[model samples]
Target: MQSTEQLDEIWQDRAIESIINFVRSADGDFNCIEKLANAVSDPDSLQKIVEFLSSTSQGKQAFQKRPLLGNIDLQKLHRLPTNSLGYSFANHLLTNNLQPLQRKSVENDYEFFAAHITETHDLWHIVTGCDTNILGEIQLEAFYVAQLYASRFWLALITKNLLKTVIYDIELSTTYMDAIAKGWVMAKQAKPLFGIEWNLLWETPLEDVRNSLNIILPSS
Candidate 1:
């Protein structure tokens, strides 16, 4: 078996290659959302995604934030309190007896989005009441894929669901997918009808805030 160091190195290399390929595919464009959508339909369109991501305001912010974590210890991440978003996510995974994939080192603007998505995944779990189980992850992935149009992520979800169905006899992945679709629709409508900022959702309780905004939670 490969040592942890070796595995980390391998993952880092693969992640770097993926980022480079994504960037090169972009040619020289800076419209990531459109490029990403197009890339989903056409693999070669990733070049535009890379270019767009490399130039975005969010991408620049992520680039600056990454170095801050370099000096800090990652293993200490596990020691954070359960109420912390990352800790909650980790706890949820432990509660469900699921293991997370090892961290992969990434570079460049494409990597920025990767990091953002990875870190924010736990926040999604908290917001959506999704657990860390395979079924829950599949559902959350569909929601994110719909919102973000990240092709590779969507593919990963599809592969994971297929494996789960074959190995565990799961039949409810479609239900999870439907939930994501509905959630997306609700979010889109709620933003306009409720007239609340997205960031405020974190500060306020969903039910109470929804009431204030006249937004109704979909039936459980």
Candidate 2:
């Protein structure tokens, strides 16, 4: 747990390193992403998220209990109905080689804010119809930018990566840009996913969850 006084310095240093790695690849190294999240300090954004969560029944319970997705049972998820979000997420994890999330050290409320967002990263992908590919990763970050009120870290990554692609691979620039645009629209139209109790929804039908959240898959 880092002290409040140390947060600014720590975040700036880590943000710089995270940017360099992100330029080379959109995935941006899992560990680096965590550090970058830890570096961000936005009290207003966090307060708004807290207020949003507090306003809903499910969100209230989620905030009070602080349920973690890591506690999810992979075997049970596998046994869920094929059309269930849980089953799909379990399969997604296995197929994509994505590791279960780990908790970051929380020195204060702000750190906890960072930790919560880090933990929910994959759930966002699951709900947003994004995949684990490079394009999907960038698009997801773009979605977060819009959803989180133009998160600086997410914006920085999206801008840097888009610029890089445009400079070296101009043809692919449109594709990446399109993904970002879709993410922005998708997030804007859908419910805020941060406060969701994903564990409870595992056994529920994926379509139902999507419909409830107003999450529509982009037509191909």
The weakest ten consecutive residues by lDDT in model 1 span 191-200
The local distance difference test score of model 2 is 0.73
lDDT (C-alpha) at residue 45 in model 1: 34
State the TM-score for model 1.
0.45
lDDT of 2 at 14: 70
* Highest TM-score model number: 2
- lDDT tens string, model 2, 1-220? 9887798677677767766665665455767665555445456556765675567686666566665655767777888899998898888878777765758355544455466677777778888888778788877988888766637768776876776786667888888988998888888888877657677788888889989989877865
Per-candidate count of clashing residue pairs (backbone under 3 Å): 4, 0
Per-residue lDDT of candidate 1, residues 61-136 (tens digit): 4455542122222234346654443455456556656454333566754554455455454555655665555555
lDDT of each: 0.47, 0.73
